[model samples]
Target: MKKYTADENRYENMQYRRCGKSGIMLPLISLGLWHNFGDKDNFDNARTILRTAFDNGITHFDLANNYGPPYGSAEKNFEKIFKEDFKHYRDELLISTKAGWDMWPGPYGNFGSRKYLIASLDQSLQRMGLDYVDIFYHHRPDPDTPLEETMGALDQIVRDGKALYIGISQYSAKETSKAAEILREQKTPFLIHQPRYNMMDRWVEEGLLNTLEHEGIGSIVFSPLEQGILTNKYLNGIPEDSRAATEGSYLSESQITTEVVEQVQKLNDIAQSRGQSLAQMAVAWLLKDQRVTSVLVGVSKVSQLEDNIGALENLEFSQNELEEIDRILKKD
Candidate 1:
């Protein structure tokens, strides 16, 4: 790739955060290709969203091997943008990709084993047109493979200069602590963890957050709006374009219960008082904690991404407001 300097004036104001104890810095708002950048979607729209995101200082792009509808399409689409508008900004960007999910059939194809992780990452780089990923992840834990083996492969990826750092997503606190020890020995550190957490779904509060903090590993949460449940979009009914209406795997009709809608309404009022949308409020809430390096958000449009970028303007949360919001949530 050759140098094509982006309009630096466009993104000079967004916040940049450090990844835990590592020297690497990630933008406070990162973009995740888990949705929107799919094979079945419009490529031009996807490219616009990607460029708009980068123009707003979203330097980190999160991708996975099986991200697109037919699989690997997201990486391929990203490759197009990389070869075009983003070629020069490669050094300024922090691109990441993950494996550990179903990519191919047979035993060697998927899992947390050394063979699977290594092979999957190499293929991911080819798809994305990159020499190496800034951070490579085990998309999810492979229950069958030993944690030691998975950690070893991740260490080797760093040692081989195939990845700048390593991370695990959705692993338990116990599992994270266990892996931390193994990586420490090789001097290969895990940079971050991705978990599904939002105001509605606070599973990480159970233990994952503390574990990462204790181990000095940063975390970036996904589905911070609980697949848009925390927003007012579902309060009346599922819109035709909603994730639930589209039968998204992560969201379902049953998720939008009457009680859930009522809770979101209450939260919406709180956001109104704070002068922000439910989405912006939700994102700000996540960045309030220092242990969280960024919130990897997904969007379908450049305007939508622009609206989300607005959250950086109002990240402070008063203790009383947080307590009041928690009080409402505790009842459910």
Candidate 2:
């Protein structure tokens, strides 16, 4: 096949927001490679998703070391596609990868130690065939490791030029502040955070968002659709082809209770009333909060990407609608 050429007017309809105090502005919607783009997945489909994402001005691609089912295969697969398709547009993209989870079969393979993070990123860069990543994150907070050690390692990562910016994912508000202070003292570019935030999961609203705001750090939320529960696919009960129906899926069928389904149905009705799909409404709801820099959405197909991006079209909500949504979500 011929080399992939991106759409010249990709930025025309897409909106960009400044990432906190940073000069970098990410698209309203970013692509997350947590689900697909693995060696077990179809290469052609992954190509289509990447192409469609770039065509729609999604310059940021979020990845992690343990994203693939077998782990690290997603980066290998993406390296192939990126080298063939996106090598020329390197400067135009924000590529991020994370560590701090189980990766290899050794004591040093996990957590936020300086050794683990540094070695993981080196392997990540090698797998992605990139000299450096835009952002490298400590996938999660390490309860055992000293915060200074992790932050110092991140500071070192920036100084080493292995990554341009450093971030921490799944950290508590207190932890975020502590890490931010350490990174600030070290003069590291503590750019953004990756947290699982959605209409279903509002934990970030407690204090994480505020901490990020006060510290001038950006936030990119993942699982914006709550693993497809926010979409219309669950309105009539889980389809056999859905994620909930798959064995050993994170979103198990048991999680889809009757009451949860009822709430989603009501939310879907509200979305329809606003001329948007349930998934679109969910994405828009997150972006309506000024603290959110971008909503990280993972999709299996190109059509899903289009529908998710459509959330940017109508992000405004009236007071009544906000109250109604709050009422519906707060229900037991």
Model 1 is weakest, by summed lDDT over 10 consecutive residues, at 1-10
List per-prediction Cα lDDT, in the order shown.
0.87, 0.94
Best by lDDT: 2
Q: Per-residue lDDT tens digits of candidate 2, residues 1-332?
A: 66799999999999999998998899999999998788888889988999999999999998999888779989988999999999999999999999999999889999989999999999999999999999999999899999999999999999999999988899999999999989888889999999999998999989999999999999999999999999999998989999999987889999899988999999999999999999999999999998999999999999999999999999999999889989998955
Name model 2 segments beyond 4 Å from true.
none
| Candidate 2 to native Cα RMSD, angstroms | 0.8
> Can you list the residue pairs that collide in candidate 2?
none
> How many residue pairs clash per model?
0, 0
Give per-residue lDDT, candidate 2, residue 320: 90
